[model samples]
Target: MQIIEQQIKTKLSSSAKFYGYIPDVSQEIDPAAERPSVLICPGGGYVMTSDREAEPVALNFVAAGFNAFVLRYSIAPARYPVALLEVASAMKLIRKNSAAWHVDPKRVIIAGFSAGGHLAANFATSWDRDLVTEYGYHADEIQPNGLFLGYSVITSGKYAHVDSFKNLLGDRYGEPELMSKVSLEKQVTKSTPPAFIWHTVSDDTVPVENSLLFAEALEAHQISFELHLFPKGGHGLSLGTSATAIKSNGYGLEPTVSAWRDLFVAWVQNNI
Candidate 1:
């Protein structure tokens, strides 16, 4: 395990954020191996990145024979495109260093939880435009091959995750034009990458409808995607196990919900 951390320098002066993770070197296991990499964005509703979702998720991917990185993107007071640009920069850097990292650059995927899911979804939909061009990067350089979203916040409508958007847009939160622009379900297109999405039907924070709406859009566009709506679970389950729990008693942990990780890896192997 080779650990590395770097400051992601993007077009935004204030977006001097950091990304950290352990790189997978295939030579150690099989000299000819080159594995897919996952860039993880943990949920914090655009206010803060969640610790439970960051490194734990990365390690899980690593254990599944994939290289992984955890991104600490900009949050509240940073504004839109701040965190977005940071994600792009992180992707660009990972791709640029693919050889040394034993990575399959084209198979690089982005996985996010909760509000971070919104960011990942938005990036999947918007990487080809807006900030990619502004940062002088080809869309392919930062484009995710697939998106893995966990209990994501994908709507700005009736089921909107209000605080997430408020933090993302700052003063522009309620401006119809900008609000609609970040309403990810409306932004989906045929160009959006294939996705693996999961959510709890009973999630009170972000709602299952958000994932349903996104899945419907994916279906309408003929994009390949897999969605899992668990019968029961709460928001921010992270790994849904003691490993991700911040308390003494396996807080927020649900055995059935934790199984999503395995299902997700299988989906990636089969679909993307």
Candidate 2:
């Protein structure tokens, strides 16, 4: 609940600006310190990053006995490959400094919502293919243990999340094969890490089809994936705090997240 520590400023790419929410690791560094780490990317349609998305989500992980790094990662203004490379670079830095940060490099996870979710999905699937060089990074050097996508935009150009694609990837990304190239659903393979996704059917911003489609891909690949589709609540339901949204299942966004957090940690313990 306190800003006990921080990585004041950092670089995502040579020219792009980015920041991260590296929580206070001093509090949990026992003699046998070991815990999963998460990198949280927030939604801003790729145009901007929601600091709230990065900050609050990290704190929640900290509460769950994990070291969380919240990315105030760059936005659409900086463009696609830039944001992508930054994520890879950040993962490298975190992995290199895992000892000092008190995190287990093997248990790193990439998580995000909406456009941020798209990036998380991209990072997961495209770790081996940073095809465009604007954002310079060696994919072989960085990888995450899993993905946590919240209403991710997995379909590229054709069925793309119009606004998010336009803002983050530019209007040009909407061009046929380009959208499919970036679509995580289209990119899925047996090698993809496990994933956890949640979205509401009522979300109009990115549409539920996004997650459902990607979920189908995960199923086809025989990958381990978990999904939760809520009945109501619209886009940007960050904490599922919607007045009209029902919590009758005893798993509203907030409570549901706590359970998922446990599931995530357990999954890491078992898988990683």
Candidate 3:
């Protein structure tokens, strides 16, 4: 296996970083294999990126026969398009080195949790816009083939995770129109990629409706999607197992919710 770390700089900020976990090919095996990749974004309510959702999640996907990446994207102090642009930069880098990384550029998926989910979903739905082009990337260059959102922050409205929006917009948080514009449910379009989304129905922090709203939008647009609403659990349950559990709080360990990782891998196998 190869571990790669690169600084991801964009016009907005230079604080973001990218980490890749790629399996080394065997000479007697599939040396020329090009595998699918998942770029993960850990959720932090746009304040900070969670360690629980970073490398552990990436390695699990790597173990499941796919190259995986973790994006420590810019957070609160960085604001809005800064994180979005950093995500685009990471995508551009992944595609640029697809050959060397043994990655199938066409099979790239973006996965995120909480606020990171909003960033991933935003890029999935808005990658074709001129904003990305303005940042020196062709819309197609930053496109994601699939989306995997875990208890994400999708809306800026009633179901919105208020602090995530406040942190993302900063001064613009006061602007109702701008706030509404960042509401991902309103951003979905026919061009958006297929998605596999999951959220626990009892999550009070970010709310289950955030995922529901986005899935509804995907369905309304006739886009392909698979949504799973777990009967119970709270927000920010990375793997929902002891592997990602917070030692002091024991916050992440939930046997039932831990199944999301396997389900996601299967979804990729059958869909993406």
Candidate 4:
């Protein structure tokens, strides 16, 4: 396996980082193999990127036979399009190096946890917008073939994760137009990719409605999606297993929710 790390600099923030876990293929194996990839954005309510959702999640995907990349996107104090653009940059980088990296560009997917899910969804729905095109990336260059969201923040209205929006929009938090724009459920379109989303109904932090709203919109648009609402667990559970448990806190561990990873891998195989 090959490990790659690089600082991803964009017009808005220079501190964002990109980490890639690419498996090394040999002639003894399948020399012409080109693997599907997952670009992950770890959530932190737009304040920080959670370590629990970074490498561990990537390693799991790598173990599942997919190349994985993690984007520690810029958070708080850096508003709106900054992190979004950084995501675009990461996608652009991935596709730009797809051949050399042995990646099947058509099978590239974007996965995010919590607020990072918002970023991934935003990019999924708004990839053709002027913001990304203005950033010098063609829509196709940054398009994700599929979306995988984990306990995501998907709205800017009633069920919104207030802090995530506050940090994302900064002073523009309450600006109705901007808020409505970031209310990703309303942003879904025919162009948006199919999605595999999971959230625990017991989550009070971001609420399961966020995922419901996005799924509803996807349905309304006639887009394909698979949503799982677990009966137990809280927000930011990451893998919802001991591996993602924080310190002595086992609240993140939910045996039922841990099945999401395997379900997502199956979804990728069947859907993406």
lDDT value for model 4: 0.92
Which portions of model 4 miss their true places by more than 4 Å?
A: none
lDDT tens digits, residue span 1-272, model 1: 88887788777844545554555444567786678889998999988999899888888888888888888898888898788888888898888888888888778998899999999999999888886556677887788999999999999999999999988998888999998989999999888999999999999899999999999999999999998889998899999988897687667879889999899889888987
TM-score (all chains, Cα) for each model: 0.95, 0.81, 0.98, 0.98
- Candidate no. 1 TM-score: 0.95
The digit string of per-residue lDDT tens for model 4 on 133-234 reads 577778878888999999999999988889999999888889889989999999998999999999999998999999999999999999999999999887
**Candidate 3 error regions (>4 Å):** none
- lDDT (CA) per prediction: 0.87, 0.70, 0.91, 0.92
Q: Model 3 misses residue 128 by how many Å?
A: 0.5
Instruction: Give one digit per residue, the lDDT tens place, for model 3 in 160-221.
Output: 88889889999889687787779999999888999999999999899899998998999999
Error of 2 at 156 (Å): 2.9
Candidate 3 colliding pairs: none
Q: Is candidate 2 or candidate 3 better by lDDT?
A: 3
**Residues 12-59, candidate 2, lDDT per residue (tens digit)?**
456433344444544455655767888888888877776556666676
Clashing pairs in 1: none
The 10 consecutive residues of candidate 1 with the worst lDDT sum are: 16-25
Candidate 3, poorest ten consecutive residues by summed lDDT: 128-137
